[model samples]
Target: MLAIRKATVADCELIHTLAWQTFPETYKDILSPEQSEYMMEWMYSLENLRKQMEEEGHIYFIAYHNDEACGYVSIQQQGENLFHLQKIYVLPSFRGVHCGSFLFHEAVRYIKEIHPTPCVMELNVNRNNKALKFYEHMGMRIVREGDFPIGNGYYMNDYIMELEID
Candidate 1:
């Protein structure tokens, strides 16, 4: 069985571990090694994870299968009724087991729990990512596209996708 629970600051290391395990594999064919390395350090460092949970209002949830952690998702309220799905990743080994969908639904459930109103849930997904279809299947539609700079001369060429929940 799979279970998900809200993560606390104490779980930063766990999230960091999950990111290191999943991010590279997810982007291996799409991102250059240098860009992947830059992103790992930029986003998955423990200090940044702590800052995100403590200072940036991002909430993370962990997915566990048979008591072993396998995936995570994070969400942040960007406006009164708008939320950002910052990240959602599942271990490759768990891909066909519904872990990803569980995480995705948890994010939506979390937003509703906090705001209890009609809202927009948005996420940025690489334009070349295979996950694009997953988002569309989940009912998120592409709203725009952009090349967002992430420092160190790296740019994330992505499509912004959104789902409105009422």
Candidate 2:
């Protein structure tokens, strides 16, 4: 069985652990080792996670299968009716099991509950990521491309994808 729950600030450590475990594998072939390390510390460090949760309005959800943590997703309102899907990742071992879809639907559900009308849900995905197709299949369309600098001379070369909610 799969379970999804809203993550509290106390879950930062768990989120950090899962992030470090899953992030490298997801980006290993796409990013250099040094870049990956920099990203991990910059994005998933406990302090940053705490800031994201406490001050940045990021809402996180943790997914578990048989009581074992397997994945997580985070979202935050970006505008009047626009929300950003900041992160969504599942363990490679759990891929192909529909956990991604489950988390996605949960995100949409949350958005609908809050906005209750037409809106946009968007995310930034690496242009070369295999998951690009997956997001498209879930009704997202690329709106633009970007090369966002995240410090230390690295840029996130990505497609800005959006899904309409109505």
Q: CA shift at 89, candidate 2, in angstroms?
A: 0.4
- Work out the TM-score per prediction: 0.99, 0.98
The most accurate candidate by TM-score is 1
Determine which window of 10 residues in candidate 1 has minimal summed lDDT.
108-117
Alpha carbon lDDT of residue 22, candidate 1?
Answer: 98
Global lDDT of each model? 0.95, 0.94
Instruction: Please list the residue runs of candidate 1 whose C-alpha ends up more than 4 Å from where it truly belongs after superposition.
Output: none
lDDT of 1: 0.95
RMSD over all Cα atoms, model 1 = 0.6
Q: Per-residue alpha-carbon lDDT of model 1 for 1-166, expressed as tens digits?
A: 9999999999999999999999999999999999999999988999999999999999999999999999999999888888999999999999999999999998998888878889999999999999999999999999999999999999999999999998
Model 2's number of clashes is 0
